[model samples]
Every structure is written in C-alpha cells, then in structure tokens.
Target: MRDAVWRHVDGRGAVCVVGDDFEGERQFEQLGVNPFVLRPGEPMAMYHWEADQEDFLVVSGEAVLIIEGEERQLRAWDFVHCPPNTKHVIVGAGTGPCLVIAIGAREHDSLGFTVDEVAKRHGASVEEETNDGGQAYARFPSREPTAYRDGWLPE
Candidate 1:
C-alpha cells in the first residue's frame, strides 16, 4: 500500500477535499475509520460530530483538547476518546509543530458547531462550520497531493 492520504485542515477547519477517496487495506467507508494528522496552529476540525465516535492520540509534540466546553493541555502519548455525537476539536498547543493522530468512524450525517470562547482564544475567524462542508472552502486552494507530508515531523 502507498502512504496514507493526508488532508491539512486549517484553523477554520476548512477542508477543500474534492472527494473522500482512499485505497488501502482499512475500509474507511465500511469501518468508518478516518485518520488525520494535525500540526501546530492546525486542528482536526472546528467543532463537529457525527453518528460514530472519534479518538485522538498525540504521537509527538503537544496539543489542546477542546471538548464539551473546556480545554485540556496534552503532550506526546496523550490519548482522547470521543463517543458518538460528541462535539470536540483538537488544536496544536505549543510552539513546535504538534503531531496528532486522530481516528474517527465516518458518518454522513453530521453537524458543525461554534464555540465562541474557543474561537476567540485560538484566534480562529470561523464562528461555525455549517452542514455545507465545502461551501466556505470553495475559495481555498485545492488539496495538494503531498502537501501534508511536510508536517510529518515534530518541528
């Protein structure tokens, strides 16, 4: 198999991915397992949830786990689990680029959320990510084939 497909979700959680296509052993469609990596200043998503669950693991560097209505500082090896319909977001915490491994079961029916406090504190311009996932991301650049590979390190 080839390398894992990476999508760089910015602070706004705006992802301009054209399609959900990946060829690998793990069936993301059937198993609903999606893996994502987050770097410094980046996050897995704004605040959103689906029917399935999502979990996170800090492989390297540091990150802040924002869940429910609180922020928890996390370092390497830290793990976080989110049950179904749990509103949560993971943001890179410290100076260095944070390496976070996030996994979640894919669910078509999901909704976005807005956390004013988190947005204000994190300097995120987005208030809420509506159900139209790619609507706001229309102006952003298309996904670069290997762009996320640059964030593979803990810089």
Candidate 2:
C-alpha cells in the first residue's frame, strides 16, 4: 500500500489515497470503511459485519447493493450505509468499472464481525480465510475461499 492521508469531507464522507496516480483516486479511513475500484463483472466477495462502523458510496458506474435481506440497484453518485452487524454484499451492475467507496472500523474498539456472521445473516454458511502469511482471518468455523475456481472472478 502507498502512503496516503485521509481527509474529512462534509457531504462527501471521507477521502483517502486510492488508484495509481495515473488512474486517480481518493479514499476514507474510519471504522468499517472500505472503498475500491470495481472492474466490470466483478462481484464483491460476500462478507459480514464485525464490531465497527461501515459505509458505502458509488462514485461511478453501477452496482447491485445487498444489505441484510434487501437488495437495491445503485448507480453513479449513489450512496448506501450498512448498519453495524448487518450482512451485506455488492456486485457490479454496469458495463464500466464501478467506483465504490466503503469504510470499516478496527475490530478492537468496536463490535467485531466475521464472514460467517454475515453469511449466517444472509442464509449461507460461513468460511475461513487465510492470507499469504498463513494467518486465519476468521476464528469461527473454517470456510472456503470466496471463489473456488478463479481468484477474483466475479460471482
């Protein structure tokens, strides 16, 4: 990751460093916050809430937003907020890349959540995740990789 500063924006939520300098980018840093540039046909890996605050906004393209059991269509300039502990997912919904901004809090200070919690809420079983360092991402029941056949392949 590159060194970047997170700044506060009044109506725009937060902004942090994202994208290559050539591609352009801004991001936010806060509990439960995460943002990304979604390529076409990219399906967000399903994950659930942990103890932390979270938020989402669409800067470009379009996407299908799933929170709890409800689903909504989002386009450029659209925004959505997921309450802490709510199961949520987002999938690309347009021809172009979906520019999405999301934020999440650290697990220490707030309620912690894992993918399993999110899956359970969404009526699916949870799985475990391991990083290249061989660290377990979730302590609950061990789960499978988000994608079985292809890495980062859209669902």
Candidate 3:
C-alpha cells in the first residue's frame, strides 16, 4: 500500500501526489477520503459533484479557490466547505508549495468534471466528466512514484 501513492505533473510543471486510496492491502477506509498535495501555481481542474459534498483545508502555503466561476486567495489554516453539486477547484498560489487537504463524501451517485478555459490554460488533464482522471492523464506514465518517496515535493 505504501507504493500505491502516485505522482502527477501538470502542464505548468506543478507536482501533486495521491496520498492514499484505501485499496490493495489497506482496509482502513474512512469515509472514502483521499489526500492530495499540490505544488504552487498548479490548479485543480474545474469540477463538481452530483450528490457528494466536498471540503478543503490549507495545511501549509497559500492557494486560490475557484468556486462557481469566481476566485479567492487562501492562506494557511484556511478552509473551504463545498455543499453538494458546487462547481469549484483550488489552484496553488504564492511562491512555493501549497498543501491542500480535501475530503469528499464517498457515497455519491456521480462525480462531474467540467471543462473550463481557465483550467485548460493551467494544463488540467481532464476536461470532461466522462470519467474520473482519465483524459487529463492519458499521457502520463503508467508507473508513478509514491507520494511518500517523492523528495522534491512538500510533505
């Protein structure tokens, strides 16, 4: 399970990691939560939920929060709570790494990803809701380095 964490690099050269997915030798599933840590200047593609509620927190560094097509700069310890079906994305801001902890209600009918011109400009891998993280990463390497072992990224 330690090796399951994967790395993602956006068009702007932002580094992100998938912390844990509670799969393969890991039975400790808690509310279907997943952890993602992104570097500065990287934007999470625009997306929304069909039924689940998504929430976020800044563990370190700062970021820009895009909600319903609007934007707001966030600082460390800041939190974002998205009710069901809210269209949003979080972009890393400032000069260094931005650590964001996000939680989503696992039980849901569907998840939706929207194509935003701004997201495209940021080099988001996925632009449509046809699937979760497919097209956006169609060209990524098959084997990705684990988040824990990536020394170049922030912890």
Top candidate when judged by TM-score against the true structure: 1
Q: What are the runs in model 3 whose C-alpha is more than 4 Å off?
A: 1-30, 125-132, 139-143, 147-155
Cα TM-score per model: 0.70, 0.51, 0.69
TM-score of 1: 0.70
Tens digit of lDDT per residue, candidate 1, span 27-64? 34544444444556666555555677778877787877
Tens-place lDDT per residue, model 2, 33-129, is 4455455544444444444556787877787776665667899888777665676666666675666777555454433223444344433323553
The candidate maximizing lDDT is 3
Q: List the residue pairs that clash in candidate 3.
A: 125-136, 126-136
* lDDT of model number 3: 0.60
**lDDT for each residue of candidate 3 in 92-142, tens digit (9 for 90 to 100):** 778777767777675665767776665555454255655465564555543
**Minimal lDDT window, size 10, model 2:** 144-153
Q: What do the candidate models score in CA lDDT, each in turn?
A: 0.59, 0.48, 0.60
Displacement of residue 148 (Cα, Å) in model 3 is 2.7
What TM-score does structure 2 among the candidates reach?
A: 0.51
TM-score head-to-head 1 vs 2, winner: 1
